[model samples]
Target: MTKRTLYLFGSAAPPVFDIARVIEEAQARGWDVCLGLTPAAAEWLADGLDGLAALTGHPVRSRYKRPGEPDVWPTADAILVAPATFNTVNAWALGLTDRFVVGVVAEGIGKNIPIAAMPCVNAAYVRHRAFERSVQELREMGVTVLYGEGGFVPNQPGRREPYPWDRALDAVDGLAPAAE
Candidate 1:
């Protein structure tokens, strides 16, 4: 059986530290995983980036390939952007592609790719008006945003907990079910 490619993008949230394990779990679930990160995330994970590439057998991309450069990763069959920050979510909804992960997911929307996102923001950020509107906009654009009841619920600022990477992957599997 051919493995479906999953573009697992992330932002610079605390949960992003556990991305290696998340990639392993996704692979176990029959996904050919490809890792993408926001610039800050890439820097945060810099020391481990090479190992992550080896784990996924693909480069951990944080920026667009320059003009005339060949694409390294396979075309994604599905996408999951976990630990999506307030900035990433709003930028993506507003079509601001300055960030690589946001850019790919924004374009993925136009390509009709099955995409799911789980935001890892704090309650303080959630209180801002634009956050809800951005979430609504992404949902309206056909991205399955995993938040609230069944997904990520923001904690108080300065508090960190283990992120729900499993829940996000489950949503992705729902979006693109097995042929079996």
Candidate 2:
């Protein structure tokens, strides 16, 4: 069995080709991909998700704790939170799992599942004291917070070179052997 991977994304960011490319490449290499997005993210851009689901043959999810859903509660080998918004990051860092996105994240963290967050917040919020504290809390909790380039600034739409999808998969592969 291939490793299970969840591609989680936040709301309100332009779509990047790197993400879709990563999913395709990973799947080609025999990884079972799962997708999760914030509610706002669905509103912002969920256009090609059905295509993605067809490619992976797994149900794409936006909610966290729904009972009786056929694909509910699947264990993931890794969780990659891409374009992680400041709101979602802070909420997850501070144990604020009010919504499905955060709730799934909290559950992943609790289970010691490897999580990689590609935060794409504006400069101002990243530099705020509260934001730093929340990030620190996440780091302290063993969550791998991929720091954006230039540290933190207010209003800068982060540099997108190192998306870390492959890196996260490598780490997960190391942590748990892929199912045969």
Candidate 3:
């Protein structure tokens, strides 16, 4: 059987700095990982882009190719949007595709692809009405959102708590598990 592919879409969040380790974890779980990033996230990772591409053996795309261009990455069996920021969450819920990362994830819903999101927001952002609504909207659309107590609990603003990457990966594995 073919190896399951995982498309890891990232936004501009601090945890995105640890993407290399996350990719390694996914690969260790028998996933053929592909990396995609929001424009800001791409800029934040600019220095290590080539190394990341080499690690995944695929181009790290931050924007859509022009018309008639071929796709550089394989179709994903499942998509995980980790370290999802408040902006990303709200935009995705509102069906905004202004960014590449948001575009794929929004379309993933219609494609019936198994999708999961682990948001890396702070306690302050959580207070915004949109955050909860966005989470609810995503859940209503069948997304396995890893948030709240068992998932990515929001930390206080100005504080950088460690993100639970393992929980994010576990959600993805549940969505589309690897070979036995």
- lDDT tens string, model 1, 57-127? 99999999999999999998999999899999999999999878988999999999999999999999999
Q: Name the better of 1 and 2 by TM-score.
A: 1
Better model by lDDT, 1 or 2?
A: 1
Q: Which runs in model 3 stand beyond 4 Å of their true positions?
A: none
Q: After superposition, how far is residue 59 of candidate 3 from its true place, in Å?
A: 0.2
lDDT of candidate 2 vs native? 0.64
Q: Write the per-residue lDDT of candidate 3 for residues 1-180, one digit (tens) a residue.
A: 468999999989999999999999999888999999999999999999999999999999999888899988999999999989999999999999988899999999999999999999999999999999999999999999999988999999999998999999999999997766
| Top candidate, metric lDDT | 3
Cα distance off (Å), candidate 3, residue 97:
0.4
Rank ordering of all candidates by lDDT, starting from the highest: 3, 1, 2
When summed lDDT is taken over every stretch of 10 residues in candidate 3, the lowest stretch is 171-180
Residue-level lDDT tens digits of model 2 in 1-180: 645555444444543334567667767655666766677776554787787667767655677655765554356777767667778888888788777778877888888887766566666666768777877788788777766443222345555434445555554455455667
Any runs in candidate 2 off by more than 4 Å, and if so which? 1-4, 7-11, 15-18, 68-73, 148-180
CA lDDT, candidate 3, residue 68: 100
Candidate 2 vs candidate 3, lDDT winner: 3
